[model samples]
Target: MVTLTPLEAELLAVAGSVPDPELPVLTLQELGVLRAVHVRDTDSVEVELTPTYTGCPAVEAMSTDIERALRDHGVREVTVRTVLIPAWSTDDISAEGRRKLREFGIAPPRAQRTAGPVGITLGPTRTAGQDPEPVRCPNCGSADTELLSRFSSTACKALRRCLDCREPFDHFKEL
Candidate 1:
């Protein structure tokens, strides 16, 4: 297993604490975008990050924020690298992140379901036993909600309306 030096650990802490520009309430680590931080040498540090989407506009801002955070923490040299292999997924988001998202008036992504290729079917092909799940309202804790739009304030989220509260909220879409 890889071990971190004291400086590396501290650097990681600072880098992880940097918040995402779009979702100010969530840190990069909470969003699972901050992948790894390593102390390259006595004075340089390297950080690995993954974007939520391929053309996400926040990636550059996140990288700048991470570098600034590390430098502020006394790391003279910092490098932020974006890795796309093993692409990021909603599953990468931590439990704490989900909780925070719920508390912040946003519904987290639904649990993942495995399925084969999706396309136009000739007729209703029924799987042995599977049912559609409802999206819950973040504000009222009600499962009665309807999708307003596939896209929300951000590309990663969808606009939804709570039938009970009549409040529009964002739902973090599942990949």
Candidate 2:
């Protein structure tokens, strides 16, 4: 089993508890944004964060919150780094995060379909061989939903209306 130093463990505990500025209902750990925490030999903490999307404006706020959290926990030095090499996907959202999203009236992203090296295409016009998955309604747990708009309050979500419940909600779009 892997072992953690006292400082590393403390840093993780503090940083993981930091809540996402955009979605306050979930912690950074729940959103899978708090990727890793390291205790450097210089007696500083290094945190790795992955944004839900490339252009997410809340990343800065998140970083600030993380730093503040560490500082409050008696950590003198802290560094927050954003990593995009592997990129962040809707799948990164934890199961608890999904439950929170649904409870907040936002439909979570659907499971991605298996594809080859090229990956699946998404647009107004579906590829001849690609079949779009149905978007479920978070409010009533119904599959009878229709797209209202391609974009919602954020780029990562789409506006959708549930025909069964006649409720409009945001659908966390699959990355």
Candidate 3:
């Protein structure tokens, strides 16, 4: 096994310490945004990440946090790079991250289901009485919420209103 120098080790540890700007309770690593960390020449550190969604405003804040963390960890030069290919999916969310989201009153993503591999087939009919299960209210835990909007404060979530509690909450959209 290759041993990282003190500087490299420090960089890695500090980089993981940086929290997600939007969801402050969870660190970047927990959000699965901190993809890779590399240190070269003992002074420069490069970190790669992908945004939760396209054109997410939090990207700037994430980059700033990364730079700050590396600087504090003794990296004289830091480079924050974002990669878009392959994009991001809810499946990338860590187990700890889901717990944090749930504690924050946001439902985490559910397991993916498809009609078939490589494609989703629409059945000829979904009986009127067989509607998909309603999302549980984040505030009241009642399964009587209605989707208010497809988009919310973030692209990855939807705005929903609980019919039972009359409270609005963000539901992490299933990707």
Candidate 4:
């Protein structure tokens, strides 16, 4: 981990503030994809961005947004690099991001244990009788939710319908 200069930190915040192209409600910072920002020299900077997953279609849009944001902040040259060495997980989502997801009619992913491989298979329900039994419905706070589809509006999410409220919502999958 390298120590960032004050300007670099400020620029990072600016770049991170850009909203996700797919999930507009959450910023890249909250999504934990905006990995780092480095100042190469005065008016020139490089940003490290990690995608939510490999081959993510939104990576280009995210990079473009970050570039525009940095340029708007008076950066003469901005380079956004995609890094995937340390793969992103649902655990990367911040608490604030989870809250925002829930508030936005989506169920946030349950915290994943780091010790073992996560095996969530789709059956009648999305969760395969995992420790976290019910995925829960974001609309009515019901634990009797059933999986509607393995893929939701986005590949990162699963579709579920609440038995209690009969409301369908997306659940950010634990990856």
Largest lDDT belongs to which candidate? 4
Candidate 1 regions off by >4 Å? 114-132
Q: Is candidate 1 or candidate 3 better by TM-score?
A: 1
- A best-first ranking of the candidates according to their lDDT comes to 4, 1, 2, 3
Clashing residue pairs in candidate 2 are none
lDDT of each: 0.82, 0.80, 0.76, 0.87
Tens-place lDDT digits, model 1, residues 91-160: 7888989999999999998667653322322532221122265677889987777777778898899898
Query: Which prediction has more favorable TM-score, 3 or 4?
Result: 4
Q: For model 2, how does the per-residue alpha-carbon lDDT over 1-175 read when each residue is reduced to its tens digit?
A: 2477776777887898888787788899888877778888556889989988888999999999999999898888889999985777777788999999999988888666543232644554311223445677888887777778879998888898888889989988888
Q: Distance from true position, residue 88, model 4, in Å?
A: 0.6
| Model 3 alpha-carbon drift over 4 Å, by segment | 1-10, 114-134
Worst 10 residues of 3 by lDDT: 120-129
Q: Which residue pairs in candidate 4 collide? A: none
Q: How accurate is candidate 2 locally (lDDT)?
A: 0.80
- Estimate, for each residue in 17-76, the C-alpha lDDT of model 3 and write its tens digit: 888888898888787877777786668778888988887999999999899988876678
TM-score of each model, in listed order:
0.86, 0.85, 0.80, 0.92
Judging by lDDT, tell me the better candidate of 2 and 4: 4
Q: Each candidate's root-mean-square deviation in Å?
A: 4.2, 3.6, 4.2, 2.1
Better of 2 and 3 by TM-score: 2
- Lowest summed-lDDT stretch of 10 residues in model 4? 122-131
